[model samples]
Target: MDKLKLYTNQNFDQLRQRQDPLADQAVEDLIANPSFIDVINSWDIIPDQLSPDFSPRVRNFLQFYFDKQSLQETSVLQNGQDFFAKNGDIYLGLLGFYSLPYCYAFGDGAEVLVRSKRIVQDIGKRLAETGVFVMDIFRPNAFISDSRAYLTCAKVRLIHAFSRYFIQKYARDWDPKFGKAINQEDMLGTNLAFSMIVLRGMIKMGRNISESDFEVVLQYWKWIGELIGVDTSFWPENSKEAFELDRLIRKRHLKSTEAGKTLIGALGGYYKGNIPDALIRQQVDGLFYFFLGKEASNALGIKSTNALSGNLVDLVFRFSGWKNYGSKKSYEGFRRMMEIQQKEQFGEVIKLNLPQVIRS
Candidate 1:
């Protein structure tokens, strides 16, 4: 930790010159965009179905960003199917991966943003094979690997690392875009990412049921509980998407059927890193994608997961609000987020630090 601080001091410009010159340019270039500035200087995002909607400050922030007509015109329901990525809720939600650290790094302290941008640039290089936005690598269509074994291992490792950070850090927000929040597309996007991580890894591994694979798979579930503030069991019993995910996970992991009871950890215990078994089993919406992907894959006779992942964009793009719907409201803590928005909206002396509120 101390080493990181020393390396990324206020004089980061000077620091980067000494260590990496190319990365310095990339970060410098990305930070210079007009939208980037607006995102950084903004506050809250409005709720879709939740009550007490956007604060005046957040409304003003949107005014600078997406005017009412602009945002509305791109609605998934109204726009037919082309509303997911190019111009709608999914795009807005994904903006966190695209715009954060660059934007909300200014959330708590200015240094968080600086260090975050540095982290993104650095990680971007180390995992250039993976992707800055993780879905590309972990999905079915990353690289055509030299060996099938390497692809399997890479997918597993990538998914494990992603879920670990996602549950532990990504959901943690100094602001909406900065941290991982359940508010992300009303759980649609979150479920999709989680389920896909497991399925992609499993498929890459040739649907193997090895112990290590089980461990990582379980870790996926434990992490899911860490980030999702709900009864994880709602998946297998309640939602069809959840049921399909469980079915695939079970079929792939059939060997350990008896000991699977231990795999179910209390949400709090799972979050604390206690392992009864690897808890990566909450398949979220894995079934939908899996069925859709398999049907497509079989039709194409494609063996590589990366190929399927690649086609996901082309396939899902036809639906505008695939990642949308709405969400329930949370009881904001004592500080009152509404008050902060009001103060900032009217140009009152204030600074918005979402970390002070947004618990998980």
Candidate 2:
């Protein structure tokens, strides 16, 4: 607890006030590019274009964001990536049930998501897009010089920059007390939601991820943090530190708020419609309680349910080993689910547009 206090007392206020200057610069450069209008008009990633056409100047300017020139991969990172591929289904499940809801528990961070109207209005599509981003990055040999993952990270970073820019400029209701939109602390917390929280969920489900594996997963996301402009200078080094970090953040920000409730309500509605089976839906709620625990579930207004539902959810996901499921099959199934989500939201698979295009 003493060490935990030290971490919690660190000037997170400074982190909250900061935004990603590199990604913000990239967005500024992009908007100023000679082909800005032409590119925005034509570049819709309907088929998921990994590489988009940019003028030489714009491309050169954006290269630092995508290239990850400083990242050095090792056997541990490769193994971590391999672990994610082998358990793609479980990874996605943890994301939806545990990670996203856990994020919503943070009052201020959830407020930013609430202001992002697209997230509340069409959450299914957002979920699909989020899944696609994760799959792209975690795929074997991802983040290479020409890999789609690099571009995907770059795109997301730009999206964050867009949200920060727009909200600060247009959101009259945004309080200064809420800190900067998409700030550094929030970004790091989100990264933990994907990496450490996912590992914690795996442990809850009876999987025994070794300490080395856990540490490598943290390292893998550190590389991601670098690319996405999250300052990871204080990122946790092991499971113990990770837990402390998560607990510290939760202590500071986990509370009931309209923003958190709205996001979870939308999530529940989307899953309820798609799940179809009453029992599975109950299990979904159980899984929420199971992973998020009492404080977070209550923060999101998740209803209390019998313990059986959570245990059953555990039984459904728990398996003997990491590689029990084939990555290809899991990827295809997940992609199909996302396509259905997109088709439902729009008339067809929706094209990815710049935030400017999206807003316009």
Candidate 3:
């Protein structure tokens, strides 16, 4: 793939406007691209038996989500893109450590993460690299064009599908009480965690995201959810609806599971040596506490950091304001932290890998 061609954003509006099969064209272009093909083929191919066809109900669910109105050029898009540009690093942290763990709190989902077992050895580096990919795709150009974003979305959907297959084939005797891995509810919960939970975390961290910016961010993630196979009817049209749906999902599915507790411990252990200095580490811990809050922390059994250190971190954000928090210096510091983790853990810049089925 020509790197330059990959850099340009697609004219999403024009494609939507056309009466032709623009969605099909988009998918074809995505898969045909050399870079995307490489990413997909690199994943471990599971036997076809494990990869069953989508049930009719699942097919209808997808159709309902995909048949939504086209995204148009508006101030919302501008504000949404601007929000990312200004606070990309903050959002990165929220997505990486804060919001992502909720997936593990779901018993079946936790089983998938723990059973995969790849995350334990290099959790910090893996998470940081994932964060890097997310930040890259969340950029204004990438978000609108749906180029890199589409690729990332596809990877996420495939991982869920692969995990579902793995669980059904290998863990049939697994306790039915935990529910099915990557079932519709679990899938939607994960999607909500990525979008609504991340947005809420950002606000809790003291970033003053305007209402318009908030809506646009939701819109951006909604599109991502669609690309990643979330049902359209499940997509929230606004933050209020998102929060309601998230609450309902959590009330129904979120619980303390052994797998979740273990994953949390592994994550904390990974961060211990990677954060550079005591102060930074303390700040991170505090931010985690603030974002996760008492209810969630207790649910995951996440230990509290030093109270003073956590408060200090919160104060820094409270006083810094959004612009300063997302300043060039701040972004540089964020990038440097990730780079150091990559070098220390991998001995080089680490490339993102598609999540593969765990054979063992």
Q: Whose lDDT is greatest here?
A: 2
Best-to-worst order by lDDT is 2, 3, 1
lDDT of 1 at 258: 14
- lDDT per residue as tens, model 3, 177-282: 5555555455566777877787787666555656666578777766666666555455666766777766665665467888888887887766665654455455
TM-score of 3: 0.70
Give the TM-scores of the predictions, in the order they appear: 0.21, 0.84, 0.70
Error of 2 at 222 (Å): 0.7
Candidate 2 TM-score, C-alpha based: 0.84
Rank candidates, TM-score, best first: 2, 3, 1
Backbone-clash count (model 1): 19
- Candidate-wise lDDT, in order: 0.28, 0.74, 0.57
Pull out the clashing pairs in model 3.
10-145, 65-232
